[model samples]
Target: MNNNSNLFLCKATRNTYEHRRSSLLCQVCGDRNARNCFGSVSCAPCKMFFRRNLDFDLVINKCIYDGNCEMHENSRHACRYCRFKKCLTVGMKKELTRPPRLNQKKRIGKQITPPLIRRLDLLNSNRSKLSFDQWSILSNVTHVYDQISPLPKILNSLSQSSFPPKKRLRIDGATLADMLGLIYRSIYSFLERIPDFTMMSIHDRNLLIERNLHNVGSTSGLLILRDGDLYSNYAFCRANLNTYGSDNFEGVSKLLNRLDMDRVAVKLFVVVLAFSTCFDVVRPSNMTNNIQLSKSTNRLHFNTINMFHIQNKYIDMLFIYMVYRYGYIEASLRFAALLFTALQLCVHTMEAANIQEHGDMLDTIIADTTRKLNVEDDPVV
Candidate 1:
């Protein structure tokens, strides 16, 4: 019994081997395994079942028996729905079926050449020269700065019915700090837009910014006030007066009244503030140095030659515009007034810095300018 059984097993193994298919049982229906069809190993009956009813109707050909119908080779054809489901359960990929190829002829459109773009060497070509305008460069630079700077939305003046006399803003230390921070940040934005400002050495840039940043903010505030853009006692934004307590509002109101500068005057003042190069624009005392040389000329001996050049360009543009707008005498008076306002701004900045609450904000302005210049703890000259 043992010998016959061993001989029969050996013969069956040889037959399965000669058939060029795995002797392992089929994964789908537990029948004799064949070559892989799609992605899974299954017998011939399951493979044919899958291909024939690849898109079989599950509802119409529903299994009368439980979904677990016997899917062996002999019984696979009895339920096309269950057989296909078993094929998928065994990991057969339906997407392996290839789509039919179309035999339509391709039509090509007529070839047309693209128009040639002429390249001119701007460095050598006279055709690339910029035409001179009285204030085009200055105007363009200021316009770009104005576009990026954070100024308040222009609202109608306090006299306009739009600004109803609402209750005065509640002033807190936090609100005061925020207002001052906004002003300094706006000035920093304007400074960044100056041509060659970032390109200058970090030391020169920081010095130039620290020297004149206060005046820039002041000039912006003055411009807003002079243009009647402030509502009630607030500077451009209503938050401007939220920093000033009831006690300080009177002083602020008086200051705003004195800022009667025209648009041209305000622009010239902004240009002046942008170009200030003196390291100590906000001096402790009335300095004779500013009176004698002017800030730009004073910085000539230092490594701020690049800064001086850029500043001089703006200064020259301002002077030319002033002369064009007004005769020399009137221009001189306007220039003097703007210069005085810069000095006044320095005083105002100093007073604000001396306030206990503003001390941290002043430090923040220095830290921010240092970070913007990409300088380390100590910048090299």
Candidate 2:
């Protein structure tokens, strides 16, 4: 394929998997092509088709009810709007845009400002490189969104909620959704730093995310205890965990079990390990201190120093959010600070992975991705 065509494929694939947990299936046709997307797993033809539509921002489609378009399966090639909408719903953020304003470096000026206020400014905003995108999206949408989607209301309520002034480790209450959000955000940030992997084709990248989500979400045997009331107590973790692992995935017939094909955690871990392995960053086979994962009731406990480093940073964001949600407004600012620190580490971790180890074909990528985004500097056509 031509360089531009290759670039288009990579950008489409990247956008498709953005912000999605691996377990979330493909939006277009629900094909579980999280990884190893070639041959029966996913044909090159289909991938090319998807990219072509994305490259041109042609979301609407009119299916003939025949197998011709072959848009995976049951894909509503009939409605560009619905197809694109579904794509966004599944994880693609249609950030295909124009030139972004140069971020003014505030610290560039020596204006004497109180350190606490400056720090608080960073905290209120998610310390994410993707912050620009977040800000743009949040600013564009009003408090109300498409009536069929509840995401707008939820996000608005969250933004309206106040952050506690103090910091502390919380355990009184926590919700799974909060946990999922923190974890998802952290991982995405981490992955973003890896410049090497940043250039991967969409199918390969999505596979890593999809499989890892399955692994983490499907870990069985661990009990997730929840909030209690006068009558009895509810175990949100247990319930949610059970729900995540309920899908029957047994009898592996391929290198990847068809049933449990795309476990997100497993996929994510594999990619990280692969990236590490590719660059020879961390070697389990060579290291004396490295420990292999253990399986109990077929689930890794996910206990590792790195996990502790990552989890400790934001688990409290979860704890605090839960506490406040259940009526504890006077919570602490500990998690806020931790998440801030974690956000920095998250970026470093991704850079450490550097998906670019795959190749140096990165300069061309920004332009294509920008064009898919439809910005001025980078023209896709």
- The per-residue C-alpha lDDT of model 2 at residue 31 equals 62
Clashes of each: 0, 49
> Which has the greatest TM-score?
1
Provide the clash count, candidate 1.
Answer: 0
Model 2 is weakest, by summed lDDT over 10 consecutive residues, at: 222-231
What overall lDDT goes with each candidate model? 0.57, 0.31
Q: Worst 10-residue stretch by lDDT in candidate 1?
A: 102-111
* Cα lDDT for residue 303, candidate 2: 26
Q: What is the lDDT of residue 33 in candidate 1?
A: 57
- lDDT measured at residue 249 in model 1 versus the true structure, 0 to 100: 46
Task: Provide the lDDT at 328 for model 2.
Answer: 31
